[model samples]
Target: MPDRHVTRSGDDYAEAFSLLLPQGQAWPRDEGSTLMKVVRGLSQIWGVVETSASKLLEIESDPRITIDLLPDWERNWGLPDPCYKEPLTIDDRQRALVQRMTIEGAQSREFFISAAAYIGYSITITEYRPFMVGLDRCGDSRVYGDGTEPMYSDTFVVGSIPVCNPNGDPVALDELSEWPNYGLGPDTIRHYWTVHVHQARLTWFRCSGGQCGVDPHLRIGLATDLECLLRRWKPAHTEIIFDYSGLTPGDPMAGTP
Candidate 1:
């Protein structure tokens, strides 16, 4: 077994005190004597220093073994976790600290999956590649016309335009009260991936780790932490779609690489 603390010991304090005494005038080294009282009083200061040093070692050992320094560590790590912000329990704070201890900035699939895990979500990633070979970087936007909409046919609704903001009333021959000024190239489907979340992050009461009224286990809500984290860290060129169907991938050919 290991010592739980470091103690300043082995007669050093007492011996030094005796050394300063007049030569051959017997120093009262026994308990409860005046010189003994002085030695013990001096040892108290050393004791406090030793105890604090030991606690510092324990705190530096791991985030979970923290003492009064937990809040300080969180501040240094820039936590209160910008992604999730509901829980304020000891367990939740400790878990957040552990997650942040090893976090490295990344954009890999595995990195995002682990990031979601930190916020108690189960998610899967799906990658996409455009099947259109001649598509340039400035690809066309997809307008799903079934060859039946007014824009795809000669059928006309008066003052109707193919521009966005279809519901707005027409301002002029071809203008609308709110017409979109620009278009997006490479429709989202071609430049995006989807995150299929399998279940809600539901927390029930726990017996092993529950506190009387503080352990933050009654959670039941659709939290946006995972979505926020993923969106913030995803590749700049890629977009993200979230599926809350709680079912397998509905895409016919979707497969993990």
Candidate 2:
């Protein structure tokens, strides 16, 4: 187990405390408030970051993986308009990897890395909200107002599918020429709809974790832990303060620090 201690005193402390307050509201003085209890529970779990990082480090002596916190449009499937066709499918191995990493205890470094890769891919796919339009074409039919008008379309909408390679160079989509034939006219149109539907499915899997019964918070927490580990593994010059020196208890709306 790594250092299960969270350094309190600055922004880290303030931010954690802030989580207890409602948006635009100040932290309540009463310690018995429900929000305070929730905050306390979260604070206790701050050790989770250390525990997770330790597990990851154990699996890989030099555990360092690059994650695009701010992926570009091309990397994220060109959201709002993808160029590929076909739904992205997570292989059985990858699904299992996510499950293992999301478990309540320490997990393999491979599992953590795979889960991060999948999450990175999923995040990119989810950015393109139009994927659902493509899925609607292949699945059931639907109607809007009065349930009379059919929303089905002959052409399939297309989007990007993220492919996580063994080398860690995950791509949103493969070569456009490699897409499967959907028996639809014009390769371009088919590609368009496939990308759209694929993104929608990927989004769902990312959010639901593919029925692995893993809590969303766990995944998010693990990711955060991994990021911290990576940063420490490879020293950087970034300056991040954990200080909360002048913060006072008052309504945030009133501009109280």
Candidate 3:
């Protein structure tokens, strides 16, 4: 019979409570000691209790008071203004999932759809504008606009097609490419795209048609357009899994270890 050996990395037992350690500091040498193990176990239990309590408290707590309790690092990590953030990516499938998972009163479904569409529009335009215009005329058109209004107006030109409506069906690029002056000069396609994204963002986050109400904490601005804040649309702090992991120690959560 062949010999078999089982091995476990220290990270295998790690829990969210472990984040209590300070950043850049190593776990104590006694970290694996019996007492420390008990502490770790208790910390994990406390974390679950804490999370439940927070959710319950959130129902009645003043948002401002709750905001005050967040760690300074989380508060300061990204751009201060929502208007400058990039749009979140839009995926109908993901939005459906969000609807199923969250309470209906939260209206998370609409939020997901709007955020995704907004971000997807931003990314698509940011990346494909040069290709759509060809490299030569790319610099001729304005890349970034002052955060006042959408770059493209309703009548903005994109070859033979006039982008008459920001929320209309997407124009086919093949048809656009066949136009006589297709890539010869600067065009307003990028601006039109921004308008589409802006509309989505506004629908999701705005409390009133022209006023702010809901606090979108996860949204961070990469830049801005006229009346729209561009934000990264993806979920914040999602962990990407990598192969060959037994256990990997992560950064500490709080004060020095």
Candidate 4:
């Protein structure tokens, strides 16, 4: 399997991770087919990134940076926005529709590149270098870079889905105004949201930790275990620490070395 590993270290912490994709996953020959891959990747990637990064703001959709690569056919019919709080249910027909749309969107160079950047960046603020093609390099290209399939060597299968506590209802946007700032009790800041992916055909967990509606320390442990669980399928970079030795106002929560 073709794979790469990333390691990050700073004052308070140090960790290593990797992303494993099957070796040389080929692109489909048909133009339409390729586009479908893009769509699926986009939706799955968006769903995951949004759920993982929601602690920054209480909003489900961040207007500043978001991408959807749905095809015209699917778009015309109307597509459901991926929401953290909402459960996604699709019948066989709806599943097929989404599958087709995802493939088409994946094939589009602009969409693919943009989605990659967004997901990669959202993973962590830590510096990461994944095998990515820049948009400028793909400028004006009617088709994707040569019909060659990207090489991938490793894959991970999610063993089980994370179960959220039913008692924890989703925090609505309207409630944000009344929501306490500064810091609410750990229980109030933390909640679990699950995301289901079609390609991997797996359900994964996102534990809100660190200023979460729950306990920060518990969140860190869950996040760590989640990363370890993902390692069962593929290599992934996790737990990034920022270096601020020279800065006057360092992260107080980061802890002293």
Candidate 5:
């Protein structure tokens, strides 16, 4: 997910795709689009979902230490903060839903439990950590109908949580130029995909037990721990968003005429 860069491939060719719907497509209006809708539209090919509970284990108490650790933890990772604004406060329903998800996700893996506990321990000592992390959805658009069909493919990363400003100053069509394209395809019409997701990171640490506990190599241990967890956890696709409105709800994907 951190690898958002478009790399050149065979014969210096590269491409990406996106799905956009014309106005007047059908779907009921709500406060906003549901998380299920966004998650379902992603490509089914390859994705990495490192839950908040899993990451919670890597942090420790002490704001000073975490502040110091931030730069190092993020070394070589160029995660862009395109919004340049603070997180909007999610309503109680959303908060409860997120907490329930983290808890249930931890139940599936002991490592996630350990990670969640570690974050809980750190939160008792510090204030900057988030309660949840990494709510994302991505799918392979190159194939369709349970991935049996093959076509051009593309990948996208959600930059931030979806926010609605019903009364805030309207962002003009040209104003959206600043946001990075999902980089779907060279021809721009060969394939289509869409994504909207949220992510957070907390820090904590513990032990794996065994030998070398006396002078354990922290970095190596951490790497090994993450690798093992990734191997065992695989997310199953549970939903899909069809119909053109999924590409852009409430408004035509093409924007104002």
Candidate 6:
């Protein structure tokens, strides 16, 4: 049978109790009667129980509500990510599991931005395209440095994709500091792009949505959690260079260690 819920007040419970008593006994109808007071007290006790039951129901299913059952929810969702640092707070864990379950996966810039937002990072995607003389302006950067050389698609050999020489004699995709439009190797410009990761901002906790003792102390949490997810979900044909040039030079990127 399904749970049939009914919210009742102390007065309602008292009336029900009064009905249970034997009709032979003369029960006082006045609110000041001793029996009435005893009944009201008992009824109010059950009111506390009712309040607890309602609260339990609210927290039972929603990941955001319950803190103790987070492990169970994460386990069921295949979370507590072994590869990355686990979230420090209850809010972090809940957000991770919730996002993981809801994200169906997509191959678009917007999808990645929203996904990164869930991880607490703001990002923008920059796709690289070689300049075409007829379409591009004079001030625009050219793939061949001066736009004199004709851009042609290089043959991609299976399992033989060229790699930058370790000794630096011949440069590869990211050997140059600013990614020189022209490189000595095959044109892999189409195979690469930049994801500008914005600087982390402070999120203050408010009483409305903030969990006491939880959100107040909660920082922006971790950036790697989202970075790893983005890297994992990116299309296989291309590579992404994370540009964390928010305020200063952020974490290590392409050419850097």
lDDT of each: 0.58, 0.32, 0.32, 0.26, 0.25, 0.58
User: RMSD, each candidate, Å?
Assistant: 15.4, 24.3, 21.4, 31.7, 33.4, 11.0
**Would you list the rank order by TM-score, best first?**
6, 1, 3, 5, 2, 4
Q: Would you give me the overall lDDT of model 6?
A: 0.58
Candidate 5, residues 131-173: lDDT per residue as tens digits?
Answer: 2223312432221212211211122233432211111122232
TM-score pick, better of 1 and 6: 6
The sequence of per-residue lDDT tens digits that candidate 1 reaches over residues 1-257 is: 24476456434566566667775446666677788777767766766777677767765556875646778889988888877755545555667788778777796566777677566666766555434433322433323343323342112234543422222212233332231222344545556767878756655555533466675546653647778777888888888989887743323232111
lDDT of 4 by residue, 1-257 (tens): 11122211221121111122222446332325654445444445444554445522332232222222223334654544321122322221243344334544432223322332222111211112222233113222112122223311112123321111121222232221111111223432222112111111122222321223332331111122223222332212232232323223223343211
Task: Summarize candidate 3's per-residue lDDT along 1-257 as a digit string, tens digits.
Answer: 11122222234334444566555434542676664586566656555665555554662132222233333322443323344344332222222223223423321223433443433322222111223522224233322222322233222354433221122323332222111123323544222222223221222332221123434523333224323422333223221111122222222221010
Candidate that beats the other on TM-score, 3 or 6, i.e. the better one? 6
Give a tens-digit lDDT track for model 2, residues 1-257.
34334334333553567655576445564567666666666665555565555544443232122122112322333221121122222222233233334445322223434433443321111111232434435533322222222222224332333322222233223212122223434333322211011111122333312335532221211123224432342214332222123323323232100
Give the Cα error of residue 108 in candidate 2, in Å: 38
On lDDT, who's better, 3 or 4? 3
Q: What TM-score does structure 5 among the candidates reach?
A: 0.17
Residue-by-residue lDDT tens digits, candidate 6, 1-257: 13446656677888889888766447775688888899988899777778567556666467764665778988898988764563245555666677767889997676787776665565766665554444334442322212222222222233432222212122333333123243334457877867877745234454434567555543443456656787898999889898876633233221110
Of the two candidates 2 and 6, the one with more favorable TM-score, higher being better, is 6
The weakest ten consecutive residues by lDDT in model 1 span: 163-172
**In model 3, which range of ten residues has the least summed lDDT?**
248-257
Cα RMSD, model 1: 15.4
Better of 1 and 5 by TM-score: 1
Per-residue lDDT, model 2, residue 13, is 50
Range of the 10 consecutive residues with the lowest summed lDDT in candidate 4: 11-20
User: Against the true structure, whose TM-score is highest?
Assistant: 6
Candidate 1: where is the Cα deviation over 4 Å? 1-5, 9-26, 98-101, 129-187, 200-213, 217-221, 247-257
